[model samples]
Target: MVPKRKNSLGGGGAIPASAIVLGGGEGRRMGGNKLFLAVDGLLLLHCVLDRICPWFREVLLAVGPKDASSLSLLLEGRSWASPVRVVVDRAPGKGPLAGLVAGLREMDSPWAFLMGCDMPWIQEPLVRRMWALREREEGVLCWEREGYLEPLHAFYSRSCLPFAEEALARKDHKLKSFYPQVPVQVVPEEAFADLPGHRRSFEGINTPLQLERFRESR
Candidate 1:
């Protein structure tokens, strides 16, 4: 659960940082919600959180209205090594664009890490490595292969809020829409080689078949 909000007079006291887990997708390709899929004995969402908790002071699961009730129960009455929160999308059916707007609005931190729930292989070392490499630029995403930028696993500065809002207003829901408007730094896959098991961090679970393949490979 998101730690209780805090208010302090000292402006430099501390910055409230957090991670927003995007679990609001319709999962049309997967035929159902992929966040609940089992991976290595735990739900996919949990696996992602397990990796994220070490890096973020707080975690929020941004789910669609339809999934909030059930997801809330799962988040509640459970103890985690780190704090977590479940927030619902204010505007449903608008895809991740809406979810992101809602998440950025609710986030307490100046910098929030946006993550897709399907990437179960994200490692803590990779997160730490990326943060160290991040620039003041508005966006920083993972780059793999020749020209693949994993926008979902990225860092966003609240400074880009207006750009994101403008994109949503134009009905341009894709995450990359904000790239041109904001300075983005793409970290190549090679940069993460020092981090053990880094190659698997970009593996996203979009379909049941992919999950099976991941299981077998594991």
Candidate 2:
């Protein structure tokens, strides 16, 4: 039971920000929709949602058209996520960046922590810690020395919507395509060395092998 959209959200514990969850992936690597896949009896999507719902006032889930109706049914009315909304990707198959564009437009917060449904290992405390680094940057992202960036596990401000739109218009769907236009704080991996399982925090379970390995590691 999806909650009705409210003009106001209940207060007390949730952070003022929102968590934007991107679950529009085709999941070809996982053989099908991976959101339904489970780890320890909990659906992967549920795992990710449960972890962040307590930390944010609202959460926006971006999904392709196919999952729209089903997801509405899946919510089962989690009151903690009272103001949650399921935003369908305007460009259905254009990938995560498309999902991102849709989310940004509907978001009600200045800061939205972006993440993927497949990435259930995200750590909220570490992410909250990164909030300070977002001082003047348009967003904050995790970057590796190997030239890899974990955009799915970063934070983006409402201000980035236009730049993201500009990139989408040019068919440049990569998240970094709009990077040069915005100031993004690129935090190095070393900064996360102190958090236990920090490396796994950005690990996405997009493939069966990765899921298997993750389960084995636990």
The sequence of per-residue lDDT tens digits that candidate 2 reaches over residues 3-113 is: 222212222466667788888877898988776787777677776776788878789999888898988887776555537789999888787889889988998888787
lDDT of each: 0.72, 0.75
**Alpha-carbon deviation at 19 in model 1, angstroms:** 1.1
lDDT value for candidate 1? 0.72
Across residues 15-87, which tens digit of lDDT does each residue of candidate 1 receive? 2457888888878888888767787776778767766676676777888888988888776676666678888
Model 2: residues >4 Å from true position, as ranges? 1-13, 137-147, 212-218
**Clash count for each candidate, listed in order shown:** 3, 0
| Candidate 1, poorest ten consecutive residues by summed lDDT | 1-10
How high is the lDDT of residue 35 in model 1? 64
- True-vs-predicted CA distance for residue 152, candidate 1, Å: 0.9
